[model samples]
Target: MTIPTDATPSGLGGSEPAVLSFQDLEVQFATDLGEVRAVNGISMEVHPGEVLAVVGESGSGKSVTSMTALGLLPKNARIGGVVRVTEKDVRQLDARRLRQMRGKDVAMVFQEPQTALNPVLTIGDQLVEALQLHGVAYGNAAKRRAADLLAAVGIPEPARRLKQYPHELSGGQRQRVVIAMALSCDPKVIIADEPTTALDVTVQADILDLLRSLKEKLNTGILLITHNMGVVADMADRVAVMYQGDVVEVGSAEQVLVYPQHEYTRRLLDAVPRLGAGRAQLGIAAEAPPIITDEVPALEVKNAVVEYHRLGKPSFRAAEDVSFTVHQGEIVGLVGESGSGKSTMAKCALGILPPTSGTVAVYGEDFNRLKRKDRKALQKRIGVVFQDPAASLNPRVPVGDIIAEPMVIHKVGTKTERQRRVYELLEAVELPRAAFNRFPHELSGGQRQRVSIARALSLDPELLVADEPTSALDVSVQASVLKMFMTLQAEFRFACLFVSHDLAVIDMLAHHVVVMENGRVVEQGLREQVLHEPREEYTKRLLAAAPVPNPEEQRRRREQRHAMLAAFGDKVVEIGDVPHGPEGP
Candidate 1:
């Protein structure tokens, strides 16, 4: 079941097929009461040797459009309009042919790799199965190519990963493996959906560079679907801004990213955290709430030491004399890369693993010296939101019950009070009350996270420890969620311990910042100071890796070049002033 191909460009077309084109595409789903038009009249064209970015927020029909192009929708789906590939139409193709086109010609990288890949099967076996099913020569040739593909996607020890299951790999590694699998068949047009959502800023940059280089070398057209405007600036040659199933704006990257005329487009651009951008930059002058410490800090980790003793070698001291305080009403950001022991320190703080030698105090109560019952109460005070909401949530439980469980455990309030609080908390996180009856599976990743936050806040704790809360969300959605947390913090006067690898997010949220490396506090200061002038080497490295809207910098560069041409046209090689641009060069 091959999806259809559109007509190729005038010259330099693929002999394989006319990449992919959408003409008046409409996708509708029948509901219990009425018809839902998910994708409405979207017309797009993608040629070889180009990257066409489809940018929009969730429910904006970007995913529906791309997923429908490969015949991946439900059986009852109603699809109209022309989706042509090669000389055939994708919408007209049967199930078998559509399956063939999906991996071979049009490869798609879904948002979540944990659920996308089979849990039982090893990555190598999955790759082998894909190769065989898609008409690849088995034996040595298939094995060799699989290894090459893994290495190409920046996965180290490629051969070992082949034998490893999806769970064995980190979230970032799993995403890279999916990208590797997508590229295995030499797809004419690759659709990457939030490809870097799970990756660190540095890794994201590497992946983007890899995609650009590969696309150029293979002359493949890339249909990148993401809500991250920063990515659009970096990789997209052209873009189509979609909202509510309609194309609101379409133009070259320079036109759409820099000179965006649409309000929605402008908002989308502003949503991404700019490296040098501040609230003052947007004319919204605000300050972080004052830190509230009751006798002792809200959460005080004094001389926290955690060590990992590896077999047949010297023991590793992960956290060496780590000490920090997250006071009430203050958001403290912990920024670092993977394996820097950021999560390890978080686990120590949560009492998931007791520290080797440290004093942890909650509300002036020494938690490290408490009994099990006392510790449980202490744990309730420090609410934690994990990285992956789906994996953290129980699939069988309803969302409302999930949020209510905390209150029930602590017996903080009566049953009626707890239920009432649940709805209020849900509203606080911007989730509908009806979501209470729904399972985690029914919600989007972002929605599930909102539920997670609502559940954390249900306990009415004075402190919230969110570990990479917005790491996997779209930029605009992330901004909304970030702002929501800030507002909630102000309203409730609760402290927040925001753990993230992204500096841009830390810049926006944290009043005070703490940079960690190998579980030690490398740098600690006020947020404004840390972001502007990072003193430690590790802190500077992390700052250097922050992702900004690449277009803003690129646009500034182009404008400077144009100004140079205008100011000293024809007459010269005069390389005068570069003219101070909008921050990053």
Candidate 2:
């Protein structure tokens, strides 16, 4: 049975007819496992000039429901009920009509811009093709309109950017191009699926601002599907909370987020790591800080610089004059935007990428001066957990082998002993011993990450390097993983260098924080000093840009971010209107 909700449109869309509506929608897919119901009977609507955010954890039908709007569901999908875009029955639309309505009446901005766009095609070519295919413009006229769209989305050098391929543009730039493509025909409604999930907080803030600006200026309704509550707070006028393929709650952002009536919604919000909520927020009691003993630190970098050499052009300096120390049993968070040298520094610290200058010391031994055999011996004392477990863990390998491979390489124990250790590790990460025989593909994302963590701890290493390990997970899953990681860290007493862009997660897990910008450490100190009382303007701006889960608080933070931008001589993204020029007809 569907739960009762306010259901009525509010805010900018009040009393206006809905641009998109779902009436008792149901979706099911036929799989090898059997017929699985992905979406239950969900009824919702998005009104012109209003933002309706559909938020839930993975597999909760948020994406499935949105996909129905564009008729993008798979052939195996058995869809029921009505999905109306501008009151046109989507289920009844013919192929040609569906294509005609796709970019003209409604469009979609996918989650990953890289996959949404064709890599081989230039940005200009793709945009022009979209315009031409939609019968919006043609030839030189389409090219000019493409440039205008890029500019409208705030990408500088729009004309120059048009000639570059997707790989040439930064992540944020590529997203802007995708948005430009979505707006080529001035669609009445745009469906954005996890639009800012992969972006850094500052870039995420910018993208949200851009979307909000475009929605108000063009009066285009938006259907936003994401698991990010902070994003909902920032963008949504109305909120729809989905759980187990059903809409459990629906109302204004304030009603749903601030005063959630559903138990699931409350749990979801509670899982979100607020910027200032330290370990105590997750029920992890704060322990005394690690003792500063005379023993060598677990890892130390001294004026390190890492550079990537080009064929003939100047070398790209990824990190410069970077220095920090991770003490034994301590977790040091390295925070920065993408390409801000966080990962590069991690690689150098791991000895995967040798620094161009300066020294990296591991347990008081200089990694650069170590002999090959000694280096391998030293490496055996360290472990690593990458960001994407699916890519990092071999698919064909069973969970048992993946965890035991590290011990095997180092010849740590006999076969029986290794299997025993693997079992112990499975229990440590809160995974069943039965998971030992299962492949990585068989596990859920959280389980796969748990496997990764289990493998990292198998070697009993003194230090660990974890790079954005929880970035891809849902809030609830992330909270659980963080709690388990804290428990394991306490048990193992290993020092960790945790790299991530999420300030909230950093605040929750890190004992000390290091802020980086343009490959330099701008600030480094205890978590309280760096987060609560940041001294640098950049740090303040970063904190201000991070969205809180509360709509009221997010609004105030938005204003504070705008003021910070202005104070730093950086103007907020102001996309008032598309300019008419000779480049267009």
Candidate 3:
């Protein structure tokens, strides 16, 4: 099933045979509510050496369609039509035969590698287990093969990594390990489900490069399932736009992304936040900068250095001389990679983690100098919105109670007053007042996050710390939330410290930007100065790694990134010159 290099990009009815194909696929799940039709007669295919991306928002049936291809749907699923992997019908295979077919014919790389991997097992153990399960190798032979797989995926010191547990590796390394396991048996096609969704921008670029390299080297087809339009631009040869259980549009990546025929596809593209677009692109009017005088800022950090004390080892420095200010009625975005101390700085600002040295001040009150009661009192004026709203809000508690709990703790008002405040907060966040009685799990991801925002604002805090608030949401929901956030901040005049890895998000919201790398602030200035015209190499690299939604623009950026990386003495992650994987000794 080899596709010619010059083959036509259109995938709907190609001349070359498909390595993976879905014919009139339909899936219905029998839930407590009734039968839910997840996929409706959607047909797609992945030719050898081609990347076919199935993209849509959450509950659009993209994931459901991919699940059917692997026969990974649950027992209650009522499936129709044919799913073929490597020209073999998946539904027709028996249990034992299905197990044999899975890793050999097709494989999957899940969104969260932490969940996909076994926590208790070493990396080598899991890799070896995968190899042995597919009868690829045995004992020491398997160990050698495992190391080779890791190296092939661009993980350095593969032999040393074999002994490390999942928790010991960084998010990027863990994803690489998962990818190694997927490539262990040398499947004909790989199903990657939002593989880079949880990664930092730089790490995501690396992983994308690795996947691209492997696809070319192994001549394997990839069925990429994701909601990120930038990733689709960077990866897909052909695109399938899924919406409410139907394939609304199918064409070459350029046609589908640039000149989308479907309304839903256009809407999806509209929702994507483009880098460097800033507030103007979102139709948010620019505000005059707040006047700064001798008056104290809302939150200030001066020469702050935070370190974690390890038992035998020297203290690990997380933030080194990190200094920044959030003025009244202003938003300052802290942008960086995962280990770059963005969250660490947020925690320190929230007073959850105290800096080992220097000072954190809130409106002229120094956190380190204040007495216990005084410090607690100062904290009353500060609000915090965490990244994942589901974890932040208590599942058993009603939304009203969750929002009013802060007011209750501070003893701000009577019970009746608190109820009134809760209703007001709900309206402020654009959630219906009826939502006050519902629990966290009963709401959608967007609604839950809105509840989290309401809870954070309950006490009418003058300062707000939002830590990756919209990272987990779908594009449209994120757009809605971001718009609401800007409006609320303007109305409330609250100074905010927004911590996120997304540069585009920061560009949309932040008046000032702080860029960090390896526990130090490399650049800080006005948003335009730092993001658009960055002077620091680290800042430039971070901006370069952030993908744009346009295919042509993204291709240009990718080329510039490679050139920049080479000039800066860095290398892109490519398949290493290791032993040819499953086919070789």
Go through the candidates in order and give each one's C-alpha lDDT. 0.76, 0.86, 0.85
Q: What is the lDDT of residue 214 in candidate 2?
A: 87
Per-residue lDDT tens digits for candidate 1, residues 1-585, read 111232222343434444788888999989675898888887887778778888887778888888877888887689998987645688789989998887778898878889889999999988877776776647666766777778777777989889999987877788778887887776778888888776766556556766776676777788898877777887887788899889988877778888898999988887777665644433234766666655556778889888877789898787888888988788888877666677887787677877778776667777567899998978888788998898899999999889999888887788888889988988877778888889998787778888887887777778788888886676677777777777678778888788887777777777888877767788899887888987775665555545456666754543444354456442211111111111111
Instruction: Mark the 10 consecutive residues where model 3 has the least summed lDDT.
Output: 1-10
User: Model 3 segments beyond 4 Å from truth?
Assistant: 1-15, 288-294, 366-377, 388-460, 577-585
> Which ranges of candidate 2 are over 4 A from the true structure?
1-11, 288-292, 365-377, 388-460, 579-585
How would the candidate models be sorted by lDDT, starting from the highest? 2, 3, 1
2 versus 3: better TM-score goes to: 2
TM-score winner among the candidates?
Answer: 2
Error of 3 at 41 (Å): 1.9
Better of 1 and 3 by TM-score: 3
Between prediction 1 and prediction 2, the one with superior lDDT is 2
In model 3, the Cα lDDT at residue 96 comes to 93
Full candidate order by TM-score, most accurate first? 2, 3, 1
